[model samples]
Target chain A: MIELEGLTKHFGAKVAVDHLSFTVRPGVVTGFLGPNGAGKSTTMRMMLDLDNPTSGTVRIDGRHYRDLAEPLKYIGALLEASKAMHGGRSAYNNLLCLAQSNRIPASRVREVLDLVGLTAVARKKSKGFSLGMNQRLGIASALLGDPEILMFDEPVNGLDPEGIHWIRNLMKQLAAEGRTIFVSSHLMSEMALTADHLIVIGQGKLLADTSMADFIQENSRSYVRMRSPQRERVLDVLRAEGLAAVEAGSGVLEIDGATAEQIGELAARHQITLHELSAQRASLEEAFMQMTAASVEYHAHAAGEHKVPAKAPPGAPGAPGAPDQPGQPGQPAVQWGRSYEERRRRRSSRKGA
Target chain B: MASVPAVLQSEWTKVRTVSSTVWTLVSALVVTVAMSAGISALMKATFDELSELEQATFDPTFVSFSGMILGQLAMVVFGVLVVGTEYSSGMIRTSLAAVPQRATFLFSKMAVATALALAVGMVTSFLAFFAGQALLGEHRTTLGADNVLRAVIGGGLYMGLIALFSMGVATMLRSSILSLGILVPFFFLVSQILISVPKAKTVAQYFPDQAGSKIMQVVPDALGSDVAPYGPWGGLGIMCAWVAAALLGGYLVLKKRDA
Candidate 1:
């Protein structure tokens, strides 16, 4: 189990990680979802005490990483691929060093080598290993201590399809054994398939913390794509009913916050949308984008501009600044950390423009 | 602590497995012995007929210079491999994470470096001593003489100290290239230049390389001159102080740094 309370880290004036708080429980895979530069790596580093947090604390199994008697025995973390082993050393020797430090028997080195399927290359130098092979070596190093808590940052970044499937199953298997597995990734599609729970962050602030099912159910809004001879006419009618719609290019209007039943009823009343009116369920990607679009910090272009678009669609209960319960004081809105365009597209009225 | 032994074994594996480790150690041994032998043989054949006092006062500076120069080169690399290798390869993170007790990791590396350097230094000193003596025939003094034994053995101690001293610099600089860049020239060129400068010459005599070189001196210089603060042990002590200071600085930075 891992718990973080008010975890914050500031790199000079820019806040790399805001006052973020979340718990990772055992028996499940908690996917840490965030766009690039969303403080995922910084949070993980602070969690492992690799980087000092400016104003918060992170506990693993109810104890700080530094206070643990045997740190490796308590938390097995693969921070980066290159942190695994020296390239010139053989795989066995690398594990041997760690095993020696933690007082594990030397035989365990071979066991992990075999477990990672690198036994054939055990004595050979790791300098020539591929990215996938290096990742496996890193996993072997992490599993060497057999700690109940595991943390990996972007484990499947450069993996092949087969390697991806193998790791996905491995994470689930590790979780099934009641180990707390916290993995970070930028891809919502991968998390949808792998995560039992999701903690979404954008621009260094918590955007959503919920189970996968709840996240998908609560934030999943339906959209309708309309193609008709009179596109602007249908858009104007939908707009009059206060429905949100945007032209998705190629004369297709994507209407949001309205289902097919209401759309068909309105279309029948207006004598329109006879050509096409297809309903589109919001994907995890869209829900993720909607939840975090306002809080993203670093954009590809901007350096220090922290601007959250004001017109982000009303999201589920945990949308920025929303309180946890009715009539309760809501948390202050997170300080925006990115440029205006990267945060939101403002696609509310494309056809008019 | 039993962990100390484990750490040593682990570090030994780290030092031996890498090609740099083998090359550096080999360079130290080969350069020291081969250079000493070649220089001694050339000096003996060339300067065969000198006065007894001239021969007696003759510092093995020429023969010792071979191995010292080579040993210094190898020791620089050896010192670098001990600390700088971890930074280059990023193995220090794994090493530190394993042994979270920071001082233990630093001390263990020092122990490994000390033992390996001592063994190599002793062998190279013995070979250089015997080879130089053999090449000089009647002109060369035997190890059985009073100061001869101390000088011969002192050669070994000097090499080891130089190795440790280099390792200390490596820790401070934190890069093999930077450590070597600063260390090699300082030992070979800068110290010489500093010693030749009339104003700085007195202080330069106490600098690490020059002061440490006193250990290999069998006889005092004929000119009545003020001597360095300490003789053989004092020179080695100066170098030792440097090693301790470097290691301490490195340990403190490493303990506090983000790595």
Candidate 2:
């Protein structure tokens, strides 16, 4: 178990990590999610005692990292590959030094080499290894000690599809053996598939810490879509029945908190000919975009008509920023949330152009 | 706390595994011995060309070490590469993670590299002395001669000290290129050039190399070089001070800065 209590780090005038506290539990794959420059790398460095925190403490298995007799045997981390090993040394010698430091047996080095499928190139210098091969070497080193807690920072950054599949299974297999697995990534799609729980942060602050299912359900909106040539009649029926429908452009009406069957049945009762009727569930990717956008918006514009209390407070799911927000709804917060999403999309496309 | 022996063993592995360690130290020995032999031969052939004062107080032991001016640069490269490659290749993070105690990590690596350097330095000095004395003919000094053994031992110590000082400077600079860029010239060109520039020679004599080389001189004010304010050992002590300050600064930087 890895516990960070009020962990914080500041680089000069810039706050890299601001009072982060979370426990990574064993027996599950916990995914750490954050946007770019969100202090994920800095937090990992502190966990290894490579960087001294400005304040607070990190305990691995109930003791400080530096106090551990053999730190590699307690917690193994893969921070960066292709740059962490010496180019002049062979892949085998690179892991050899790290293994010898932690008092790990030399035989285990070969075992890990085979585990990562790098047995053939173990004698070759790391400088000649490709990105994929270097990543495998890094993973081999991380697993050399066979520690209980394994942390990988974006382990899938430069892998082929097969390599990606191999790592995904390896992480799940490790978690199945009851080892604590903590991995970080900017891609929510990967997290949605691999992570059992998520701890998300933005702008160096905790945003959400919850189960994967609950995170998507609480932050994302799933609704039904309807398209009818007699859209006016469907709207009239929906309004008469005290149901709200939003025109989602392109002659489609999106209705929240209602099933497609009910909407279809209501249209039939109103004798409306429908062109399309389907239920749309918001993806985890969209939920993440919205949640991260809300955090950025909170940092930029803390006050205005958009009420953070109504939308982000009640089921904030362990967010430290929730209780600090104003505790009343001055206006609907969904309007501004959608607007922020639009702006983010436009800004990204502009950068691409 | 980390196990000191385990860390020491790990550091030894790190030093021996890299090719730069062998290449740099071998060059230091080969270059020093070869250059010393050449200069000793030149001194023997030029006996008649020397002034009356030069021939009267000729220090053959010091002449045998004339090649140190160029050879010490290799020792500097060895020391710099030992510590600087960690920063350049980003291996420091991985190495630190394995052994998080910064002092233990830094000191252990230095201890291993310093031992290797000293061993090679001793061998180089012994070979250079034998080869140089053989080439110098009648002007040669034997190991049994008064103060000759100390001078020969001092030659080895001087080489080892140069490597150690380079290690300290490289630790503070944290880059092989930057450390080599400043150290190669400071030990070779800059200090050598200032030694002939009138008043500049006064201050230049206090430089680490100029002072540390005093230990290898058997004759008083050897080979007509200027008289130093301190004895041979005292000159070496001054160089030791510079090395300590550099290592302290490096440890502080490692402690306070983020990896």
lDDT of 2 at A349: 52
Best by lDDT: 2
Error of 1 at B169 (Å): 2.3
Q: Write the per-residue lDDT of candidate 1 for residues A15-101, one digit (tens) a residue.
A: 989999999999899999998889999999888776778898998888777666567777787767765578888888878877877
Residue-by-residue lDDT tens digits, candidate 2, B12-65: 999999999888889999999999999999999998899877887799998998
Each candidate structure's TM-score, on Cα atoms with residue i matched to residue i, is: 0.87, 0.89
Q: What residue pairs are clashing in model 2?
A: none
Cα interface RMSD of each candidate: 2.5, 0.8
Question: What CAPRI-style quality would you assign to candidate 2?
Answer: high
> For model 2, how does the per-residue alpha-carbon lDDT over A159-258 read when each residue is reduced to its tens digit?
9989888999999999999999999987777787688889998777888889887886686665677888998888778877767676654576767668
Highest TM-score model number: 2
Candidate 1 lDDT over residue span B88-141, tens digit each: 877776676667677777778877887888788888888888888788665577
